[model samples]
Target: MAKIAYILLCHKDPEAIIQQAEQLTAAGDFMSIHFDASAKSESFAMIRDALEDNPNVTFAHKRIKCGWGEWSLVQATLYAIEAAIADFPRATHFYMLSGDCMAVKTAEYAHQFLDDNETDFIESFDFFESDWIKIGMKEERLIYRHFFNERTHKSLFYWAIELQKRLGFKRRIPGDVQVQIGSQWWCLRRRTIESILDFIRSRKDVIRFFRTTWIPDETFFQTLVRHLVPENEIDTRTLTFLMFTDYGMPVTFHNDHYDLLLSQDFLFARKISPDAKTLKARLGKLYSSRGIDFQISNEGRSLYKFLATQGRAGRRFGMRFWETESSLGRERELMIVVCKKWHVAKRLTDQIRQETEIPAIDFIFDEDNTALPDLGGIQSSLAKRARHRRSLMRMLFEYFESDRLIVCMDPSNLDLMHDFFSDRSMTRLLRIECDFTDDYLIGHARRIGLAGDRTSQLTLERLLPTIRNDINHEADRIRDAGFSRHFRIRQSDSTETNATKLVEFLSLPYETALKLAQTRQLFDD
Candidate 1:
């Protein structure tokens, strides 16, 4: 039988740790926990008293004050490992876990899996050659001596790094050990663990170098295990399921993640929220159940890879493949109903919707009422609304098979209008220019109370010409960008505007166009 010892590094929430300890030890496994020195003294005392009577549970003798992306994490982990090894001499493997981690499968299954595979499970790859550092400093991490925690003192940390760079100062790796980077979690066989400890004890200079290195916890064990163990004995994958956001923060599992956790084959998953009571309770029950059916499957592993790929290069960043371009409205006929006045645009869109069987929507950026074709949820911010508008245009084609659709927009939103005008392949622009005289605009502003006082009213009055000029300028730009036709409807000649010309430009059937033209309210000022 395989006996596994767990080393848990925790900073907060003693009750949660106590619960995890009880569940993990139910299968006759040993647990060694290290509480961060920075955590409240009461939290540490509470956990120690709760588990003091349990023979399988031990606490680290040395506690370190840990900070994000600092060397203290590595020290805390080392203490936990030392305590586990000293107490559980019969243990076959040592698994590193965070307090947030919970068993996704029965402990018996995890022990059997570890026994069957003698190789150490960890993620280790050459740091200098790999593309792991996507967002921040890469080689400088190893070369520069960092004295500050980047998360807590970002400005000072970066300033020190810059100062070192300008002075041509650099640190050297103490030994011939190759630098490897990976996730901090790992499951190591006893021999491998012993080898890593022996190496650490013998190398004082190595400790000095990594003491100030950025995020050494993730790198220290990874780099040493490669040097100490044979290549074939090391598996460059963690047994724990973990994921990070685009911002490089860990994705915490919550109460709703019960099904999500059940589907994973990994023995444990980490960064569970403290408030995930339901998820922890259910998984905890399943953890110690003797007859719980647990089968090893690749589905969860496959899902992790799929989600990671999508997160890095998906539509969130506006990335799309050429093969799918035609499906995103590249080949479909699109009509843009452009106008500055909200009421006029809404009325025209309603008239078109009444006249045609095809989908016609209006005012995606409307202040009071946003119109979506197949999507819902009114965005509250201007930036979000603009992004949704863009998504609406792209996704609309995939949802509908109609030959044409009408999208009414207010060009007053220059941010959205300019983006629409840049693409000119299959889109037609129908512009409505309201010819408001100076007297009419001034009187209208006053009647609507556009501003409070005389000076403010005068400012609103002066803004009228600028708005008209911007609309006219955009029309010229759109025409120059190769949009085939521009149908301008003015208040003076609204009735005389040729209906047939408008119908041809929009690629609408004559009957539908006739009905649309007959709706005199569409052209009414």
Candidate 2:
């Protein structure tokens, strides 16, 4: 087998990294590891012991201690590549891989690809163009120095960013380097890797410029390479395969991505750790549409059994309804819009309806039915004088088979739903909240007083923080029933923000949500 240098950046997950190393080293590849300096010494020792006396393996003495989006990532790669060059002088290709990534292909196939495309530098694309430009992520990612990794510190960093955003301020991009980004994983010829390291050492200013930039590992080599290597030498197609979340997180592949892995010509796939998450991801993908035969591995079966045993006592709701609820391209996504009272629900519902033009089924419990506004729809519309909250929801679910759906509940009346209709599992909840003072003055109590409920005076008492408790209780209930993710919209939020929040909850695209907010009538802010 041809000598390939695999540069693995390991933080935690030493076991998984060991498996990753084992997969490639069998092909007689030289593996160079740079363990995160912050990692437990015992774990690092364990990783070293696992690959002990493997003449093909080398460890970098200069370990870097950095978290996500730090200069340490670049340093670690540099150190690993430097070590690999010194130890495995004969290695033809330098491959950048992560601790979470596993080799999907045998070494023979990988070696063949390397042999065929010897000069092609894998994954060369202009990061500043296309999607990043449209989404406007460059301002946040490229300009800002997001060095802090701790929770509180990161929160403060974002808080300062928000203040800066309001004040119309921009962070300085350190040097005169053409800034761009790309997928961090790549297989490059030995010369390209050496050129990158050389450029870094020679142009300390360029390296220093990228240090304060977010996730510089993705950009540093990519930006510098175009200057060093010819455009014809760069092959934009990456050998590493990945699927990302709405946020750019790589979806952890398990058995579900087995077919995808086989279908691709890629050599590596990332973030495959822990059988449970991978199983769940596979399950989510498999069950994302109409019934397909999916075999459950022992680990998968165990995961399902464990999930079933979790949450509060509830009837086993099959995944069929969930699939229908979660399926993409459905005419309308359903949102269970629960608020404290009639006026509050109307206000929040208006924010959603006006911004997104999505039909909202409001659970308005007006005794005289005069105050509640009419809504439009087929046999399922709640636009006319509303029924009691529970009955409306019961009737809605009876006929509603998950098409453009939302439910509204007042937390004060959660007792009406104790063990009844409301407890039936919803895919997610979007709580609509109002200002507490306004809940008494402009919302529940005021409306109750107008409607002449004998308990109008007590309504304010019940309604105080009633929204939060009810929302929290409902959140707990749904999560207990295994519908864990939820969102919120407060009175303080603008209509557009609320619309985006609701759209996200319903899994609608950001563009579609944005169009709704922009084109739709009566947008808030």
Candidate 3:
């Protein structure tokens, strides 16, 4: 039989750990637990008694009092692994889990997923460099300094500094890569576990270094692995399961630690609290009725549902392929000039008339003039903005009808156009910050120019070259207008506007506004 070992580092939650053990044992997996020595003796006794009937449960004898921000937890974990190795030599994998954490996927499917990925699926949480942790540390330091003496302050500061050094310290491992140390709840193959243990045993200096460090359990293993394996082989984003909170802190469910697990498509389901007696009955019934087997994980089901809905919506929207046939023997290239204001549209039309002799430029404004009321109020202002947005969208759709390349001068206009014609292939001259590269806009135009000969789906990759070309052309025209050094294309996207308007809108400081205007002009030029 294939065996998997679970290393449980219990703190204050003995009951929760016992309940988790029950579930693990019932799932037909071998289990081993290491209780923190700092825990009350009565609690440990209760835990031992609860597991006495279970043949798979083996309790460790060593006791180590683990303080917050100390190496005690790592020591306890190492001891547990050493015991497990000696007892279960045939075990295939080792999974490090907390008593508070619940399994979001069924045991069998979770195992299979791990096997397929050739990695242990541990939750990354991504809180290492988050603002929350930064703020928390600052606040904690302040409190300690105000209340404690020099010796006490030194001890606290050392813990904090050491933690920062270990966890947040950047190290260039093999492959010329760099990454910070991570958490303790990781998965490892049996061989990897043995290798890690052997390496630790050989490195007496490393163990000595960890003795004074804060939360060495989180960093020690990660640091060792990064040094040993190729950086790419270490799966950092293995955290598929998430316990949603208002912030980073975990929320309790049913008076126990039950974190909600979110699926890949953002669908969420509650993980049953370990201590909840009604879990088995409630989950069993729900699982059976929903036809969710251990093999069909929550994420798998969510992905299937997401894809089905997207396909249905795509069909409903009349998603069509791009016309690839070039305009053979056609005199004009399809040109779409999208703009917000009628004056700007007219100006672009005039520019196109002067620059491109081969293709006639067509301009369309989809503004709903009727929606604007003569009366002055918030409603009227909103109506005017809506009309302006709509007008830009209409201009975007018009690009598909023409054989010419498209041009959008205003960033806002481009955004509205992209949103409206998301399903269609249209070229625009604006680049949003979210775009990966400057050529996104240029490529769109190039693809449309080539579309006369080929038929295919228009993607971001196809449109970038056209975007760059249009930007360059626009820059040349601006330079010719004699405002070359004073004005430049900071961004062609509709999100930015004239320096005077942007400065006022952003409420930037005077000096900052001037600097921004300077950069904005550089792009405009």
Candidate 4:
């Protein structure tokens, strides 16, 4: 039989967390703890001091700023589990318990139960099952990003998280990883725990995907365990007894519920608060149990207390990918011009100032620009490439407050264009059009031709139709999606006035529009 490693993730109820630590230490089991980084500093220190005598215990070096239902909560749990693996080399079974959880069964019996059975204990189920889901629910969590709301301070994101779920912005869960949801508490074998850690450390796509998701804790581990661990080797039952209540906190157990805890055949029971004195007073006298002179507060599953918990831990994960220099803030009407590369959309913005009083912000996504990183090879360094796009997404979030966003794509970079508008609300978009063969090559050649030297470029015969076909396909897709503002601009000798065409395309509401007196002729200086 292998030694057991007890991993505890503690945020509140310092005394209870430490008491649980001491009991496991006394049981000759290795114990590890990770305190929430955002918790009151002194309380965390006090808990450490109280548990100073326990040699079997180890604390995680780094603390995570954990939030309820967000990915950070899951991050803290991962850190603790990783720390436990480093602390105990010989331990084979790993048990995860909350700060309020107490071992009701004898240490000998509990160890025997784990040692005798080859089963891995975990509680999980398909989240999309009808009973768990409401009728006519929108896309499942995997498809859409669930987010937290600011005003009401609840996870009101049946919509997108601060990071949109649409392509280019959000990370996708691996196709191999199935959807699983269950009780947040569970136990895993050493290998199972290691497999999960591997997933966390190397799985950038999954981590970045859940970073903005709501209550990712429920699915993060459940999906990993179910996908990696074989069904025969795992036990689907939860080892602890839980009581859900209307309030955020679980119902405390008194002497009256002692039999009920034992009757459930559960090894652990929750909630040893000061109010549960009758039940805890007796359990405190047992060997390996230490004195609890300090009273620690327990902030339980607060989402239940809607208004109360909303005020606490309301901050979701901040945008992580990119940084910005613009000063655009709330309550201002701003326009965004996201071009394919440096000044690719310059012509589009020429008459914009003549048309609108509101200022416009420009963000260029072209990889050639100094602002963005290179879009490197597919396999060499995926982490860097993923971060590259993530930086772009962060840039998108910055300009998200725009009243109307105009995404301008060029023939050279149509692949990167679709992602710009996918995650954004269609209502916020004023127009999405591609400009092909818009004097880019000829104009640039003209500027450099003044220096009396120029490099050879592709012939118009080879470039024109290819760009035309690509822009046509892109335009068709956006129009089919019901965006009436989608159009294409390809200027030629017989083509209509470029400026006048744009003026009508945008449908700008300006008092005095700047109309070009005479459209320039092609190849004119």
Candidate 5:
């Protein structure tokens, strides 16, 4: 058997780690976990007990201080890898992942896929031009000055500005520099692991540089891998998961539906008024209405009764009865759209509402809103149409005070709309577009029956969206955003000396060329 070790560095939410570990172990994969030593003793004990039953799980002790950036994370990761490699020397590859990461496919499937590709799936993008790295530097400088120099946690922004003046530096890193960046989660060949460790041992300057950097975790491995391996040996573009977030939190269905569920008395065993008889009677009727013929416990019956009331109230108010919640927190707002045929929209809307936590308002163009209208005085020319559309978008955006907005569209229609909203400024108008095309890949996964539990539905509805102007575009948007450099048509791939032609054909902006070259992984992916 080819051994693959799963390495996780966890600080909080050990349950999530255990959940992920269970999936890996069931797939016949080896596992090693390193938890922050500074966590509460009870939390550690709970994690220890949970993993004790799993023979594959090995826990390591590591002291990690919060706010240490990637330095602490890398330390923990390296320690786990060393231990895993020591015990499983014959292991074919080591997969590094976070506790929060959930596998969309089984480990066996992933292993086979990797075996077929025969490539290391580490994101090897040049990090120097990445917005995250530049932002990290600015954030670190500000935090250091406020907490260390001023001896107070407040005024970090002011102190950062002062320090910048004294040091004669700016927050932005020049795009030409070859810095590396990627997800900490990666699958590495044994040789690659050893090479990285050996290079780190010899590069004292690199270690010193990271000690003071804000997000050392994201950069250290990227820089080390870039230095140790031939670029071609590394598959910089491929990612097993495409993570999207608003307001620095993971978006999930749980967070979005809780509020709407509660408002209608459909959650918490229908215990809203504490009248057991009323709850049971209501729940019994609700079950019958849904064609479900299962007996509920007294508690379960009450809960269902309350949920039915909540569902009725949500419908009366024209609100989404289900939603996926974002992990960002309660302060954010969210909107979700799913592209299906006209009849499918209603079912899709219900499914989306049940699965996500954000408040979703279904807008079926055929049922709720009119199709695109020809704007008066607007010419059909691209420039004229784009300007007019922008004007209309600006007016609509100003009406909402949300920090995030998502526009979900059908895949077939994406190309038609790309020309109207290809500008970077659209990012400021709409932050994310959840294209249903991407969801097709997961259709083969096990299907859970439709849930009508008011409590379940209520939890789904209360979730909100944070981080205004978050955009989720399909592959077309990515292509329009100049990702063409990362890939070439099969025919063009064999052609030599076509760099000029490629650039001209793609119509890439000259200003972004250097940045594109440095961070090619974004396009390559």
Candidate 6:
């Protein structure tokens, strides 16, 4: 009978917190909530009244004014943890959670897993050796004292660091304890939590050092769990499934991510979208029910890996282009039309559609950098569309499933266009203006919303001369690759003729196109 006490650090969304508290208590678990002191008193009152009847629920004795990357986060957690321990004497384990977090797995499974493993589930590694510190100062985070809030007073915080660095002032660890860094989310056994509390009560110097340490919440408990718990009884991983973006922001789970979250071995997931009523309800239902036994699935791992490495090596070199939603066995001709001018692309696409049966889509990457208008039904966050550009191209290939598909790409997507330059499976046609004019450059910049200010326009004016050379070089590179031919469409060249030539080029297979490109004029412009 391993009962768990869930200590939740909440700042906002009182209803969501109440829902979580009810779900956990119904599953036979105790909850201790630490509401931020800065939050509205009305909201806290609402939560208090909602859970007043629930005997398994308790509020922190003291409310802490929490701030991001500040010591107050750890203070809030400690307050809740203390309250949980005092109230839930029968609880054998303590799990840390946020207001946004929801249980992805049932409590029965969690209790069983904890009972069988008999270890603390936390992420802990040597602070110096850890690559987990993706953003901000690493060694400096420990060496320099951070008095200002990192998020709110970013300038002052960095200024203080620089001042300390220039003064050659550094703080030393109070004790012989090893410094560790890890995710703030953790689940510790009762004995381990007690040991941590005991360490805190005894070590005043260590507490003082951590008080000024930058982002101590991520390090404080992570480091102490290592020194307090026996190495053999510690599992260096979190039971909470948390994923961050390329920009180091937490990924918010939504209704569509329910299946993905359910596949994980994690007990809970955080940063759930507040408007995700269906996701919250479904996950709440899972809290009390005997959900599927925990087992790591390869597909689940791959999905998480794909998301984790978005805009990185996972999607690098168009690796995910063919893998994502592509029908491999089906035969289809994919033609990517690369052009610098949107008007020219639209004209070419209009001509192609009127003259041939090929599906020619223009401006795939528009103002929002989204493919939704061109290829409907696949809605994604603006960040994903911009970051994972190749994923959108793959989706285009998969969605249409037409025998012949032509996608009109703007010069802004030059990186994506270059990715398919060498791939012989698809046919690529390049239409670029080698002669750079002030009007043309200015117009292009305006279209892309880059020339909003005179400074940016002046900057573009300076880079105008090299733009012609870059396009010519890319055209030569395509010719050299021998995989595709670059067709230059001048203003004098007839759009109808170029469209006909493109139609003929698209009709040929990769081998035929390669041979035609090398020998005779497959594209006449």
> Judged by lDDT, which candidate is best?
1
Clashing pairs in 6: none
Which whole-number lDDT from 0 to 100 does residue 164 have in model 6? Answer: 94
TM-score, cand. 4 vs. native: 0.51
lDDT, candidate 6, at 31: 96
Per-candidate Cα lDDT values, in order, are: 0.73, 0.59, 0.46, 0.55, 0.45, 0.71
User: For candidate 3, what is the lDDT?
Assistant: 0.46
Worst 10 residues of 5 by lDDT: 265-274
lDDT of 2 at 104: 57
On the 0 to 100 scale, the lDDT of residue 434 in model 5 is 25
| lDDT score of residue 491 within candidate 6 | 48
Question: What digit string (tens of lDDT, one per residue) describes model 2 on residues 327-392?
Answer: 222233445555554555555555555555345555643233322211112122333223333333
- Which candidate has the highest TM-score of all? 6
Which of the predicted structures, 1 or 3, would earn the higher lDDT when compared with the native?
Answer: 1
lDDT score at residue 235, model 4, on the 0-100 scale: 76
Q: Please give me the total number of clashing residue pairs in predicted model 6.
A: 0
lDDT of 5 by residue, 337-358 (tens): 3233222333333333343322
Q: Which stretches of candidate 6 lie over 4 Å from their true place?
A: 291-298, 307-525
Prediction 2 TM-score vs. true: 0.55
| Candidate 2 stretches greater than 4 Å from native | 132-136, 149-152, 162-176, 245-249, 256-260, 276-525
Ranking by lDDT: 1, 6, 2, 4, 3, 5
Q: For every model in order, what is the number of clashing pairs?
A: 0, 12, 44, 1, 56, 0
Judging by lDDT, tell me the better candidate of 5 and 6: 6
Comparing candidate 4 with candidate 5, which one achieves the higher lDDT?
Answer: 4
What's model 2's lDDT at 209? 67
